[model samples]
Target: MSKMQPKIISTLKAYSKDQFFKDLTAGLIVAIIALPLSIALAISSGVTPEKGLYTAIIAGFFVSLLGGSRVQIGGPTGAFMVIVYGIVAEFGVAGLTIATIMAGIIMVLMGFLKLGAVIKYIPHPITTGFTSGIALVIFSSQIKDFLGLKIGEVPAAFIEKWAVYLKGIGTFDPMTLAVGGLALGIILLWPKVNRKIPGALIALIVTSALVKILNLDIATIGSKFGEISSALPKLTVPEFDLVYIQMLLPAAFTIAILGSIESLLSAVVSDGMIGGKHRSNMELVGQGVANIMSGLFGGIPATGAIARTVANVKNGGRTPVAGIVHSIALLLILVVFMPLAKMIPLTALAAILIVVAYNMSEWREFKSLLKSPKSDVLVLLITFFLTVLVDLVVAIEVGMVLAAFLFMKRMSEATQVNIEDFDASEEKDGVPVEVHRFDSVDLIKVYEINGPFFFGAADKFISALGELGEKTDILVIRMRHVPIMDATALHGFKRMIEICQRQKTKLIISGIQDQPYKVLEKAGLIDVIGEDHFFTSAVEAVDYANKSVKAHKSGIDSRVL
Candidate 1:
């Protein structure tokens, strides 16, 4: 089957009634689990609660209908909280919609270009750093609502936000804090009673009812954002301006990259749980379509929700049908029960988000990574601090560049150039053995390159060759272990050839691997140096060099006679 084929198409060919029942059950359960989560995540992302349901309903439907994973549950997640909040704060909801649509387009292009596999190469330390940083930022953002601080507008900057929170400490409402604590306690303890009914939902119901019954002097969703709309989201086309596009392009790219990483990671995790494979490229395409539809429907950005996906798998969701059902179930809730969402206390939502932040923190991973190599630790620290203190875009950009340079440094260190002499003694079976030395061994110099010949190691190769004395009659380069060579290394070889020609020294290359040989052949280096001088092994090259030296001496003798 093609990699672009969605998993649903294949599964439905053999779909059974029994499996359909299982899918339905799992889907309804996952929908229940996703209810409070979707709303809480939307609020945390600086959007109205209804947008979260819109994302779950629209994006979730498309993702399941077109996705490559059997059990992927697409919806708004905590991962986007920081970036989405920033986008909404800077450019408003309209700007966020445009950016999300742009990101979706980028993701589609990436899938078509077959860059799915390339995304896996993003370093773990960078992911861990940014995730933990985002967690911290999210936790800080929720502090206002959690403590019921009477702040009109919270600053987006991390430090400034904390300063504002500190200044409003005196305005903290005890009633709101009590409601938040009750919700948190329910979420943390509800699993022991009944795991199927999500703790978040239970907390949402209990806290909303308590707050409404008591008429607590606290801010509820209704009081702040007004009535929750039960009607289906209408399609919205954001006004596109060149200035806004240019200003928001970076933000769009950030969303695309982050969404890709999170969705693919969730797919991989689900694949392991179900013993199935997911088409990564197809998954990207599905997520792209989902996000585009989400943005069009006035929804926040969406991706595969890891917690929800796991819940699906655990509940016997073995096919994409379950995912589709999940979206349908959410839609029903949106149309029927959305009006009650207004009574939910803001502090309860804040508590749910705080739990989300804790789960996504990856604090243990961060602590473990600090004990890694110094270079890795440096990248982690820089990425972490930059993400917290600066923009996520800057953190990811700088982290990638720094990781690339550090990787090159490590590879260069691995690329070894060892000088070999045929006159050196050898050992056989732990006993000293006499090695056959060529007659012109003193005149022949050999250097063996034992790793990838790339730009990082090109200068090292040239410097190693420079160490050869001027009296050399022939230079043999052994490249048996060099699996690959880049253009810079090829240029270095050209320079070496020039030096050999200047000194009237014969150049012989031996044991070139297939890839490096093809590179040299394509660059016309083989023709420039003559194919006859190339050998399959260093021994052959050394033998040829010795014979050439003897022939030269004989020609001189004959001329003298």
Candidate 2:
């Protein structure tokens, strides 16, 4: 049993023949489904349709074979459309390829360092916010093709894109609208007819056949981008230079982060669906390999496509073999049926992307989050707006910073520091007690602190200690409720003890837990105070204070005589 136990390399073994048949069928189904969507995503990203196919065939295969998740399907997805479009606009195809390859290497290193778990800490609001924002961008991009508007170039900026679409409103073609409507109709209704054959394929075939039969003057793939090649993709290296690498690093990091988050999230979602677990680090490495290979073949960045992966699992895909087969099926279609893809109308492809946008928006979650804690809602809205109006890299960076600040705010609000008058309160009952007092002044100082003594809260704790007067002889700090501490807090605490030592006052620590006690010892707090000065309770601490006062009085009398 131990020998057969699952490990990273062991899980790579191929499935049995019968299992392979199931996987093949499921993979073929997903591949057919991936085809139209990939083409749509590529066009939406301002790239050729074939690049999407190359991504599906090359990146999609490698990710499944090497990824942590058993059944995640990797390909061009709606999530990457915004970032890829931005990169292409700013740096061109060669630049995009180099950035993707670099991002892939970063992902592989992240997996090696076991940074998979850290990715989960990204706030949920930020994810939902950016996802919905991207959906809006994609939905907007489809307007030109969906309406068959005579717009030459769409602006890349979110606001500018809409402004251009408005200007071109008069150029709307009714025939294009009819085709988009028909395609949408088939997509929405075809599921009721058959699940094995995808709705997208049906929509594309019907739309193409109708357009051809009617001799419609609509824009097709061939009209816009010419015929796609039937041959397999050849290996190509992106033009690489130090300047180019430096320029593309930020974009590459953004791609890496987005891919890591999306892929890991998809794997987790798949795990829930199939009652299986995924090795997250392994999955990161697989995603990295996919991107690197995709770049080598002149393909765009790829990640685990949630929709296709869910479709694979729903259709009896139980192993990574299913994902591999999906890639092979796409390769076969690219080889034999590339010419047929030319017949697909641009309007039909636009309609498919509209559906993709709708799924990506997740507006329901956005609305629900409005009623959540204000901090999270702020993060969500900030991330959403930034992603739409500015750039994804900026959105992620600002969103993370804002989320951290909000987290600290919540923690600070929860923390409390108080000066307890132990003499007047709960100890009035008939319980064993130790009397401690100052000889000159009848005062006992008891400090109560509640919360983590980490760096953020350290200053606040130290400031509270400043309220003590010079006449005070005994200072007892109670840390019974503090669960953790950091070097900054310990340093601040040591300073407060030194202040007491100079004023002829004694410092006593009460209620030290094992963890904090070890921490204090390691920081030399035990040696500073002497071990006998520490006590288990406030009563013991006060008892030691009283004894010290008596000893001080005797020394004062001896000096006077």
Candidate 3:
């Protein structure tokens, strides 16, 4: 029952041979699906193809062994492609290793600190915006390979990258484009023919065979990054100084936040499919360990892949065993089939990544979000544009701040302060009746506050009280509808008390809720305003104020006599 317990440990208690067989089948299928994707994502991320397999093998194995979700299949995913590529470009692979390890540490800390639930609150618009932006960026990054453009290193900036692509448009190799087209066509159309087999795998095999048989002069994995390594590279500690750590800290935080979001989202999706609950904190811990191991093993950053996890669930995978099998199966493919990867055309991988970009784009969601409220639309568009035109870090940072301010504005509008006059007449049993009409009604002012009294609404509270006339004998604040209060609202109340004291006016509070009462009591405002002046009902407080005013007037008359 502990939140830190891995789902594998719980599921294994009731495990059966039948379920193990099912898990095995599903795992092998997922591994097939992951193969071309892992290679393509790695190449797209500015790393060698073998590194992607390293991530899938190392990170995937650990995630399955220790994850909180029964069917979460973890590995290198397209969502991380943009950020990972940026880190690799800026700091090189060594820098990326350090950042990834640092990110893993942060994730572990987040899990232990019970911050898993908080990460889910990231605004949907921001997620969608950046995702769509990243998709476009990924698409842009692959243009060189997709077209076989004779270009040197592509620029990192979005605009500059496109400019370079345009300049080299004349140098595109027709054979390479044909290979990419064939791969893209197979990927898009293969599901209709055979749903069980992964389209990317078929495309990889068909395109590679065709290119080799024809002896096309297209750039292949071997031509660009050399042969894929069949063996895992020795684990090495990333060398770093304080300057690199400080410079990479923000990048590391980005990776942690992004990885946590993607992995938890995957776990949640898998949980729904299987009608199971996942330990979110434990999932974070698992992902943390996986990423740390991935970095040590010369792998790119990794997280739970939603598509693969969904495939696992649909293929009868009911436990983490399937995920574990997926990793093992991929490793076997790496050690046995890695040499064949050398002949796979780069254009085919580019086509696969293009599909990835399309899936990641979420264009329909982006369009729907455009029709949302203007504030939401603003946040979405700004985040999207900033993500494409600038850095993802800047986009997320600005979007969060903008969303927070807009949220405060909406909350301020929702909170209301109404000046109430108890002068209305009502009919009782066909007879006219007066409700709380008193002689000193004009002297007693009542302001009823509605909604939470927080910093957002504090100014409104003060301004509402400013409407009081100089001749007011008493001020009563009705807080029945106020569910909570914050320090800012308490400060406003203190200032109100000061004004009442200056005007020699009696202050009374009525219908205060428990939360606001505690807030006032903690701030010593209750004592400052006199506890005797507080009432449970507005009518009772008004009656007490009337009597007090009458007694004060009588005292004035006697002194004059």
Candidate 4:
């Protein structure tokens, strides 16, 4: 196959002025949608709000420049809230920077190795479980800001967060709750009022103005994090030790895998809307580069955002130009209006995130999964509970293991072993038809093995073979129904052959499929059984066996037995 290429080069080949204008409009629109989200997600991830804008500007621009999707918008996402918060809690901001950079390198390797499509194998149940769990965590994180609770350094654990929140009930400020409630109501109603301007921006502007004009006593961004810088991001390497890198490996891997999955899934969803196919591997590489730039410039890890991408598509965006325009729009906002960001009530951002969590919760999917098969339900519950109770890394690891074991159990159940007479079909017809019938048919035993012979079913095959009586003069193992075999099953087959050899029973392996035949040929099992002992059909093998036994009985060649 030819090597993959970025979508921008291909897209520009047919670029037009009309397309540019459409892209520009859509890009500006998505930027409005992304601005508040980037800040909220950063705060949720335990970082300064400006870092979110930095990621939206840097990662957002490069993903479109080098990405395989025409309209994918990259930035810190809600999905990373729990993970990033946990990392910051345990290892601090420097550790998070190191982990993000490491994850970027791993993502690049994954792209180079063409593993983008492979990550799609993560089960639906696991994703649903973890995603819903993340939404809950995000909602929980925003509660302190939403209620303006007077609490110091809230804990990361879910139960503990609630316990602390419960204790701080008396400290809830009425004015802050009103600001949050008004901002949420404005966001919900502004779309119907006017579609040209984004609701979040209007909500943010109105709430900040109300807080400033009314002289309300509430926590603002400046009040908490101090006035954030409006200047461009500076490049600086974070302090890291070898021990830190080793300790951060697991978190980095989790980041890489989740980032890849989220980006490709967004690309796929956008592709369906626009009737365009995205190059998965190329998309991963673009995301990797974006993340690397983000970390280098004091930002967090990022990926393609489904909400922003869809907004781009709906706003007439059909090229990478739109995504680039979106990033430029954010940068312009950061440079021009960042001073005003200081006045934005923390309650408003918290309310915005609460809305985000509610939208992304996937509670309906979670309920539907509970009604699925027991195995699926088991994986879903385990992953969900683990994510809420333990950590994201542990939840994913255990969920995958449980899914694999359940899959093996189902495969074993589907596999079957049957022993049927050679002429069973002919006897049912009760007609004298020309067919391969073995001599001394009663003494000939046919063991038909069915199913893919893999690790789980190897023991089942061996157990069935162990029941083969020693008195059989000729044995034919029919394997046409067996789809494939692995190293373990090949070993089991060799052991079965050894047993037959010791019994001096003539052995013929018939109707072997292509995959199993290739495996046996590579293992030299075919040569060990002799070429003449293999046949295309069970009837042909029976005929050959019948002829050989008759020849040995008639003293033509005693060795034929």
lDDT of 4 by residue, 274-375 (tens): 999898888888998898889899999899999899999999999999999999999999999887898999999998898889878899999989999999
Q: Evaluate all candidate structures by whole-model CA lDDT and list the values in order.
A: 0.90, 0.86, 0.89, 0.87
lDDT of 1: 0.90
What TM-score against the true fold does each predicted structure earn? 0.96, 0.92, 0.95, 0.96
The total number of steric clashes, by the backbone 3 Å criterion, in model 4 comes to 0
- In terms of lDDT, model 2 sits at 0.86
Best by lDDT: 1
Rank by lDDT, highest first. Answer: 1, 3, 4, 2
User: How many residue-pair clashes does candidate 2 contain?
Assistant: 1
Query: Model 1: which ten-residue window has the lowest total lDDT?
Result: 552-561
Instruction: Give the Å error, residue 326, model 1.
Output: 0.9
Candidate 4 lDDT at 114 equals 87
Angstrom error of the Cα, residue 124, model 3: value is 0.8
Clashes of each: 0, 1, 0, 0
